[model samples]
Target: MEPIKISGILSIILGLIFIIFPVFSSGVVSIIIGISLFFFGITLILAGFTASNIIIGILAIIFGLLFTFNIDAVSFLLGFQFYIIGIILLLAGIIGLISDTQISKIASVLIIIMGIISFALGGFSIGNPLYAAILIGVCLIIQGIGMLLD
Candidate 1:
């Protein structure tokens, strides 16, 4: 019922999908990320709060368009996905640990571990998106469980 629980459920479902159909999920993830970035870029540009924001927004838009339009680029860029996910998870864990958020200490640690694992996997399988998809799925499942527990 809560937002966290809802997120957990969605994460678990997505994780299962990723594990079941790594190839499909990988492509879909790339497209989804592309679309999200596109919209975020649009928002940033519209906001025009600062010059840096506008610059980053333009870059985001360019990359978003590239990712959305080119599947080949997505395949090649898969290696970076792990690093991005790892950094995000690491930051989330650190924030959770520092702040009184819904994420408990244990969950935060788990997230941090997942982040480290993601980085390791990325390093090992820089050119393999299928492996990355499966690993990302496993990490998502663990993160979902952590969220549920929290």
Candidate 2:
């Protein structure tokens, strides 16, 4: 159990590194995801055929077809994934504050602060994404320069 847990943690660390780097092989990730989906769908289709289940077979084929054909949907799905994660965190913090101890109460406070920041960013984005983008870029540049000077 410890070995499996450690392996899972290591996998997540590697995944975060790949995500955070200035450059990443998005195409490679996409290809891997597609392959997994394809295999999963194929397995489902085979199972459906064995059971003479037309609906399951059709769903599998449709999913398989969509995996490659619907790139935009894939992007949307990934974006939605982030949003869902944020919501989950927000919920957890709220729940923890009610049910847990001193540390969790503080965590909720920090989470609330982060949620406010996210809201502000989204509010600014609503008015002008270009302006928000430029502000973010400039902020990053300034921060990078400050870090170097330090």
Candidate 3:
């Protein structure tokens, strides 16, 4: 719409592309976060008027270091965190079932159904990606036995 807005959007898009394809910028996104942490950190640490805010700032710096220095580890940790959250949500759904209110019962039922369906679908896809491959192998083995007898 406006020139400034369009410029900002374009910049964001370019930045995202650069981040996604870090080869284009040689991981400059990571470098920037690390550098920002190293500097913003000092400012926060120096402004030690509040302990809680300082702790948050320190955590941010640590996260930045993790992002920059250990991108793969960060991604893995994020995935692990999501898995834990999913399990926690499932447990919460179970607890909601145990204690029936009004809307909670409906939410619990829906959550259970979704969990069942997701489990089934995930099993089907993950467990059978090579269905045709396995079938072909078995058929070939049968044919070989039959030919050997004949």
Please report how far candidate 3 places residue 42 from its true position, in Å: 2.2
In model 2, the worst 10-residue window by lDDT is 78-87
lDDT of 1 by residue, 1-150 (tens): 999999998999989999999988878767775776678567656744556556656766776776667657455676676576566557656655776655589987997898898789778557776786788799899999999999
Error of 2 at 87 (Å): 5.3
**For candidate 3, which ten residues in a row score worst on lDDT?**
78-87
lDDT of 2 by residue, 15-120 (tens): 4444454133333433443454456446544533433233433543454454445466655443232233234335445644664333357877786566555456
lDDT of 3 by residue, 1-150 (tens): 555555555555554554345343434434554565555455545644355435545754676576457567565442132232233335435645775333368786775665564344334324332332233334444544444444
Give each model a TM-score. 0.59, 0.39, 0.34
Instruction: Mark the regions of model 3 whose C-alpha exceeds 4 Å error after superposition.
Output: 1-22, 76-150
* Cα lDDT, model 2, residue 89: 38
Candidate 2 Cα errors over 4 Å, as ranges: 1-89, 101-103
What is residue 139's positional error in candidate 3, in angstroms? 58
* Model 1 root-mean-square deviation: 7.4
Clash count per candidate: 0, 0, 0
